[model samples]
Target: MDIAILVKLTSRAWSLNILASMNSGIPGRQAPLLAATSASRTAFAQSLDHLMQLGLLERNPGHGHPLRPEFRLTKTGAEIAQTATRIVQAVPDDTEFALLRRSWTAPILALTHRPQRFSALKSGLITISDRALSTSLQRLEDSAWIEREIDATLRHPFPTYRAVNQGFAVNQAIALVA
Candidate 1:
């Protein structure tokens, strides 16, 4: 998975949950997927449409009702879903999994494999706003997925971030996909 693709995959809040559920052998029908991901109807529908547009998911032909169609992963989707399964498994709790659903979570985690300053992370992500980056860092720090330390060796002594524990596991999962 390229970083950009991973970004697209996690852009919708429920996209990863949908993919993980499908990878876990949950039925491909909308009702089952909604139950599995616990997503609201509109969000689930949008995510399903997003995945289909991304070429990761498609309508199943000769199966399911036209009004309530079934879906299946395309070859690329299956590959990405497998990667998503690994990431889903790496998260040890629901709270952490919820963090993973955030738009910037995976990319931030991927960037934090090595210690990096806030500016470095922000620059790496390009489009993330300062507030979003700050909020994400705070959340990841609170969850203990990452650690922040003062790099006193620098002239300005700025705080740097790095993935730790389960964050490391998630980063590894992303690397495997890459």
Candidate 2:
């Protein structure tokens, strides 16, 4: 809630990415995580230490002579990680890459993991209004993450949406969020 805290959280490079990588159950050891995150060693160490200090992660200090210790999320960290997993990912939640950072983008993608029509999506999301869903779908289409299929069998042709193969990886990560 405070500006200082906001700045502090956003200041840590590759921090959120680490959480997402972990949340997807990638790895517990440093080397594997380093590879999974593709973060520079120095930056990864800094972010790992900061996350531990924030009570988000824990290291097995008593094991493996400390030099090659194991790490995992603390209870607090796991809880937060579950909640933030969608945004924290192998790909940073930057606006430049994908629209997943938009409020409903990930949720919409999650719902569209399989093909679905406009009405199904609106009803499934419940709180999303028609306009908001339309806008989110448009963004996904613009990014080429979702394909729009028109069905003319019905009196009025209706559009059904499905995610492209490339979108599946990110959508799966968000689905594993909790």
Which structure among the candidates has the greatest lDDT? 1
* Clash totals in order: 1, 0
lDDT value, residue 10 of candidate 2: 34
Model 1 residue 90 CA deviation in Å: 0.8
lDDT of 1: 0.90
lDDT score for candidate 2 against the true structure: 0.69
lDDT score of residue 138 within candidate 2: 94
Candidate 2 per-residue lDDT, tens place, 36-150, comes to 7677999889888888888778885655446777888888677656644654543454553335535566567666778899999888777678998899899889888789999
lDDT of candidate 2 at residue 148, scale 0 to 100: 94
Total clashes in model 2, counting residue pairs 3 or more apart in sequence or in different chains: 0
| Segments in model 2 whose C-alpha atoms lie over 4 Å from true places | 1-98, 176-178
Residue 129 in candidate 1 has what lDDT?
Answer: 96
lDDT of 1 by residue, 1-178 (tens): 7777888888998988899899989989999999988889999999999999999999999989999999999999999999888898898588668888889989999989899999999988888899999999999999888999997886888899999988899999988856
